[model samples]
Target: MAAVDTTLRRTLIEYGQTTLAVVVLLVGWEVLCNVLSVPKWLLPAPSQIAADTWEIRAVLPMHFGATLAAVVGGFVLAIVTGIPIAVLVVYSPFLRRVIFPFLLTLQSVPKVALAPLLLLWIGYGLHSNMIVAATVAFFPIVINTATGLESVDKELLELTRSLDASTARVFWCVRLPWALPYIFSSLKVAITLAVIGAVVAEFVGSDKGLGYLILTSSGAMKTSVMFGVLLLLSLLGIASFYAVAWAERRLCPWYLPTNTDPPAI
Candidate 1:
């Protein structure tokens, strides 16, 4: 009970700090815009951004849903595709030799640069966005999983082999379990990248999503609308990242990066 209390207190403190920081930033932004007498089109104050966001609340659901769907779908696809590829690479030297180089080359190619090409090949729609998001997200998952799988203690592997454990049994019991933390860490990163990629794809060519809203607002000089869309996108990314982190904490309760254990009192 004491440990749980301590963890809860720490969490509350962290959230309080974050909220305080955000309040300070928002206050500064509002004051700066007011002091400068910036034009509404150039730098609408926070109040203006909030009003604009409210004005578009009716249409926001559909665009937000579309973007969310793309990000989730692409992230799921990356996990399904990347893990198997990682396994093959880890197990088969021939595959590792052939596939690793290709993946490296593909990673070097800016996925945003490929956005237009994706639009050309996949057409202008959520499909292209999903592809782009998966492209941006999968590399991290594959590399991290592979590294975790390969980095297992050599002594443990030798012991398992001495016990005449089957390859499948060894992998299922040892390697897969050992690699989970790395996999989840990569998942956290991939979720954020997935959101960015979906937005980039939308930016490249789309009539929906917050990204599209930002582009149209940019042309019309609707700074308030752009700020609203930017905030929405940031919220989406934060939500996605926290979702992954929640799963990570559930699966790896022993892996606390911030030393959640109670300190000496």
Candidate 2:
């Protein structure tokens, strides 16, 4: 109970600090807009943005749902595809040696540069958007899973080997469990990137989703609506991040107890 209370207090303090910072920033933004006599078309006040969002609440939910579906679909695809590839790479040194450099090269080539080609290949719609999002999100999961698998304690592996554990058994019992934390950490990052990728795809070509709404609102000089879309995007990112974090807490409780108090740094 004492430990739980300590953790709760620390979490509340952090949340309060973040809320204070955001309030300061919003107040400053409003002040600057007023001082410079900035047109609403150029920079809407937070209140205007809020009003715009409230006005479009119904339509906004539909657009938000579309974006969410694409993001979740692509994110799941990346995880499913990446983890298997990671396992194969770990199990086969030959394959890892041959493919690691190519994987790195693929990751380096900007996904935005390939979005047009993807659209050409997949055609416009959810499929193209999902492919782009998955491509952008794949590398992190693969790299993190591979790193986790490779970083297994040598002593632990030797012990299992001495016990004559089969490769499949060793992997299922040891490697996968050990890699959970690293994979979840990567998941937190990948979820945000997934949202970005979905938005980028929509920006490039799409009639639906928040990204398309943003483009439309900007073109019409509906600055408040554009700001509202931006806010929705931010909220999407935050929600996905916390969802992953919550799953991590549920699935990997050992890490929290072992780490004890949060680090000062």
Candidate 3:
């Protein structure tokens, strides 16, 4: 109970520090803009951005829903496809040799560069955006999951094998649990990348989404609206990342990240 209390206290302190830092930064920004008489079109104050965002609250729901759907769909697709590919890579040396190079090549190609091609092939719509997002988010999940599965303790493997455990049994009983941390870590990364990919796709070809809103706002020199959209994007990314982290804690209660708590005396 004491350990739990200490961990809770540390977590609260960390959040407090982060909140205080953000508040300080915003305060400084507001003061600087006011004192300098900064042009709103060039660099709007945080207050201006907030007001602009509030003004667009009605339209925001539509754009927000579009982006959210694409993000969630793409993220789910990446997870669905990435994990099976990782399993195949782990279990089949031939497939690993054939697939890894291809995957690396795909990863190396910038998603922004690939967005146009996806737009052309998939047409300018939600499907294309989802594909782009999946492509952007796919590599991390595959790599991290493969690494985790292959990283099981050799001694544990030997013990399991000596017990006449089948491959399926070994994987289910030993490897999967061991790999949960890595899988969840990849998920957190992939979710953010998914958001980026969706926005990039929207930038390339869409008439909708926050990315479209940003592009139009910039062309109109509505810097406040652009900043507001950006702030929304950041919130979306942060929220999704934390959602994954919360799931990780629920699913892998035994897993504790390093340095999250002070050393016990």
Candidate 4:
């Protein structure tokens, strides 16, 4: 109970600090824009963006839903494929040699450059955007999971072997638990990347989503609405990141890093 209380209190403090910082920044921005009399098209004040966001609320649901769907779909696909690839890479030297180089090369290619190819191959739409997101989000998960699986202390592995534990038992009881933290860490990163990937795909080829809205609004010189779309995209990314973090905490409560743990009282 005491530990739980400490953790909860620490979390509250961190959230409060973040909220205060954001409020201060927004207030400063609003004041600067008002004092300078900046035009809305050049740099929309937060107030103008907020007002425009409200006015566009009617159309927000559809565009937001499209982007959300693409993001989620792509993230899920990355997880589904990435973990298995990591496991294979960890357990099989031949597979690792064959696959890891390919993955590294693929990761180096800019997603924007590949987006057009994906559109051509997959056809433009939700599926293509989801594939783009998956491509962007895949590498971190694979690397992290593989690293975690390989990170078990050598002595611990020897001890497990001496105890005559089956491979499955060693993996289930030792390797998987150790990997959870790394996996979840990658998941948070991948989720944010997924959002960027989806937006990139939309930018390249799609007629829908917040990215499309931003593009169209910019072309129309509706900078306030473009800012509003950007704000919405940021919120979506933040919410997705926290959702992954919440899952991480729930699944691996014992894995807190030293830096993040609350100070001793």
RMSD of each: 2.6, 2.8, 3.0, 3.3
Q: What residue runs in model 2 are displaced by over 4 Å at the alpha carbon?
A: 1-21, 257-265
Q: Would you list the rank order by TM-score, best first?
A: 1, 3, 2, 4
Give the lowest summed-lDDT range of ten residues in model 1: 256-265
Residue-level lDDT of model 1, residues 1-265, one tens digit each, is 9978878888888889999999999999999999989889888999999998899899999999889988998899899999999999999999999999999998999998989998999998988888889999999999999999998999999999899999999999999989999999999999999998999999999989888888988998888989998988899999999999999998888766777555543
Instruction: Return the TM-score for each candidate structure.
Output: 0.91, 0.89, 0.90, 0.88
lDDT tens digits, residue span 1-265, model 3: 9978888988788889999999999999999999999999999999999998899899998999899988999999999999999999999999999999999999999989999998998899998899999999999999999999999999999999899999999989899889889999999999999999999999999989999999999999999999999988999999999999999999997887656546653
Please report the candidate that would top lDDT against the real structure: 4
Which candidate tops TM-score? 1
Candidate 1: how large is its RMSD?
A: 2.6
RMSD of candidate 2 to the truth, in angstroms, is: 2.8
Candidate 2 vs candidate 4: which has greater TM-score?
2
Cα-based lDDT at residue 71, candidate 3: 96
Model 4 misplacement above 4 A? 1-24, 257-265
Pick by TM-score: 3 or 4, better one? 3
* List of clashing residue pairs for candidate 4: none
Error of 2 at 31 (Å): 4.2
Q: In model 4, how large is the Cα lDDT of residue 100?
A: 87
